[model samples]
Target: MLKLMSLEIRKHKLTGLIKGVLIANLIILGFMVLVLFVDQNEQVSTFTSFGDVFEGLFVFVKAVFIIFASALLGRLVIEEYRSNTISLLFMYPIPRKKLLTAKLIIVFLFTFCTIIISDLVLGALLFWINHFLQIIPGQLTWILVKDELVKLGTGALYAAGIGLIPLYFGMRKKSISATIISSVVLVTLISGGFDQARLGNFAAISISLGLIGIAIAYVSIRKIETDDIT
Candidate 1:
């Protein structure tokens, strides 16, 4: 699986996606900082506590990466099927299911690792900025750190699974636009709310949605051999 994933990465030149990820992180961080700075000058509390900051950061990170993962699915899976290049891949000595699973695994791990890393990095940068600028109130404590570590782990897992959800839509029609658009709608449904009352904040909702994505992947892999690549 690892060898196949590596081959897929090399064949697709996916290392280039790192630049896109970095740029996305920078944009998210900049927007966050700008919001805080503006709120500080207005004497308006944008985030009342460090927990709020963490939640806000995680929401942004998860939203971005979920969409990003859908794009990856489009490139690695749907595009191949759409272009009929997947027929060529089907001719390989590899088991069809194994090949498809490798692609899904790569997308999952990429989304998972990137979301966690980007959130941590951006959180640290925000803390450093707050230390000097005093943009947000309250002190960071060990308790907060411990709690957030748990949240971060669970949140990333949920997000990684949710990221795979778009594959179901894309595969239905072999349409990249459908994949990306479905992701956007999913993000809005999960992340949109007044004052941090997002659907994603609910553990039950996140878990259920994540499981749906995993199920989608499982079904896709199980049916790969019988699927008509033509």
Candidate 2:
């Protein structure tokens, strides 16, 4: 599987995506700074504490990378099928399922790892900025850091699974636009909320949606051999 993944990465020239991710992170950091600035101008505090800042960081990371995953999926899977280029891959000696699975794994791992690393880096940077600006009140304690780390890990795990949900829509229409748009809709639904209550904050809902994404991946791989690429 690793071998196939390596080949897929090279074959698709996915290294470019790494650069794209970096650029995206930088943009996000700028947005975070803007948010802090906005918070200062308002009478009500948008981020009352470090915990709230971390939560905002998670929401942004999750929403951005999930869309990134879908775009990757569109390029890796949906576009191939749409162009009938996947038929050439199926002719290779490797099993069709393995070929497809390798692509999905790349998307999943990329989404999961990027969110964790980006969150930590951005969180640290935000902390430093806050130190000078005094934008948010409260001391950053070890206990809070530890708790945020836990939240980051579990959130990344759930996001990795949720990232695959777009595959269901992508496969249905064999359209890259459909794939990305579906992901946007999914992210909005999860991240949207009334005040402090977000749908994604509910552990049960996250778990359920994540399971649905995983099941979609399984079914997609199972039917790969039978799918017509001609």
Residue pairs in steric clash, candidate 1? none
Compare the candidates by lDDT and give the number of the best one: 1
C-alpha positional error of residue 118 in candidate 2 after TM-score superposition, expressed in Å? 0.4
lDDT tens digits by residue: candidate 1, 47-130: 888898888889999999999999999999998988888999999999999999999999999999999999999999999988
Q: Give the TM-score of candidate 2.
A: 0.97
Evaluated against the true structure, the overall lDDT of model 1 is 0.93
For each candidate, the alpha-carbon lDDT, in order, equals 0.93, 0.93
lDDT of 1 at 146: 93
Per-candidate TM-score against the hidden true structure: 0.97, 0.97
- Model 1, residue 202: what's the lDDT? 88
